[model samples]
Target: MNVVEMLQEEKVVAVLRRLPSETFLDVVRALAEGGVRAIEVTMDAPDGAELIRRTREVLGDRVLLGAGTVFTREQMQAAKEAGATFFVSPHLDSDLMHAAREWGVPMVPGVLTPTEVAAALRLGAEAVKIFPGSLVGPGYLRDLRGPFKDLKAMVTGGVNEDNARAFLDAGAVAVGVGSSLFPRTDLEARDFASITKRAERLVRAVRG
Candidate 1:
């Protein structure tokens, strides 16, 4: 399937941000074990490119790997070289959009206002991401759909198992879940089982 189709099918993208490198793979494995097929490792993580490369090598085709929080051409290029099939950024940028096109990688750039959404589409973003999804809630997506019915939007930030399905029902193609999926205390305690259970719960909530 195409990137967008795969994302819609997965219904969830487990986003890992600045996680402890030592347990990175463990966390990924746990998520995948819980049936999450799409995963994103944010660029802010230490040695992010290498981590992407390693995850691709280790996970093979079992998971769809993506690079998140991308804002520059350099970051996009590095992520592409490191085997990221898709790129996601918190904001729209022309340079990064063009790079993703040239490299033949799908990019999902964040957009808030209707004007920003139009700009992102014109810039060739494969999909638009609504960051700080908490600010507007699922109702906002429903409102956007009234005008941009064909728009593929991924909701991120402040997402949790409780509201994941609501976002999808409101027109979100998928949701990017971060800290809610990997609680800090659980990570510190190496409670991978808990992470797995959370992942499973989210998958059920969104995909049901």
Candidate 2:
């Protein structure tokens, strides 16, 4: 399946930021073992592009890989070349969205208001990610749907097992979970088991 189809199927995007290259595969393994099928490696992470490439080689088509924190058209193209199946950003950028469309990569651009969401959709984005989702809560999603009923919104930031279900129940297509799902301290301790447990909990929350 393509990235868009995969996102629709999984309904969750596990964002990995600040993860060491050495532990990247281990993290992917833990999440995959816990039934998580989509993962995003942020460009801010060390060797993020290389990690994405390696992950594609290691997991093949079993997992959907994406690049996050992409800020420019060049970065989007590079990510695609590095085997990123999708693109994500913390803010909506028309240029980046256009590049993603040109590459045929599923784009999930961040938006904080109805105007931005409309702009993103106009650019052909498959979905819009609501950043700082904690602040707005699921209620914001419900409100946005009122104006853009056709928009597919994913809530990120401060999304944890405690409130993941709330976001989904509120009508979000998916949620981009970061530190709450992939804690850096725990991973550094080589606690792959803990990561697996967290992933499992998140899976349950999203499913619920």
Candidate 3:
């Protein structure tokens, strides 16, 4: 399936922002064990390209691998070659949009306003992500959908099991979750089971 179809099916993108390069595969395995199929390794992570390559190598088709925090063409190209099939950016950028289109990979660009959302769709985004979504809450997405009924919306930032359903109910096709689903304390303690459990809970929340 395509990224959009897969995303709508999975309903959650487990985002990793600061995962150590050494624990990449194990961490992903934990998530997958809990039934998460969409994983986004952000560019801010150390050796982002290598992590994307290794994530695909280890997980293969069991997961739909994605790249995040990408804002440039070079970053998008490298991640694409590393087997990334989708991407997310903190903001909309022309260069990044062009690269994803060129590679035939889906990109969900971040937007905070109707103008940005419209522009992102105009630029060919598979979907537009509402970043720092907690700032405006689910009502904002509901409002955005009022006028852009057909536009796909993905909610990101400050997302947790508690609030994910609100966003999904508000018209979000999917939600991007970070530290709440994969806490630093668990990772530091090497408690992948906690990550697995949390991922399962989050998956249920998003899917509900």
- lDDT per residue as tens, model 1, 33-117: 9999899989986588988998999898899899999877888788889989999999988888888888889989999999999
Better of 2 and 3 by lDDT: 3
Pairs with steric clashes in candidate 3: none
Off by over 4 Å in 2: none
- Higher-lDDT candidate among 1 and 2? 1
- Which sequence of candidate numbers ranks them by lDDT, best first? 1, 3, 2
lDDT of 1 at 186: 92
- In order, what lDDT does every prediction score? 0.91, 0.84, 0.88
* Candidate 3 lDDT by residue in tens digits, 144-190: 99999987888999989999999989988889988887788987888
After superposing candidate 3, which stretches have Cα over 4 Å from the reference?
none
TM-score of each: 0.98, 0.94, 0.96
lDDT of 3 at 11: 90
Q: How many collisions per candidate? A: 0, 0, 0
**Which 10-residue window of candidate 1 scores lowest in summed lDDT?**
70-79
CA RMSD of all predictions: 0.8, 1.4, 1.1
Query: Order the candidates by TM-score, highest first — what do you get?
Result: 1, 3, 2
TM-score of 2: 0.94
Scanning candidate 3 in windows of ten residues, the lowest lDDT window is 16-25
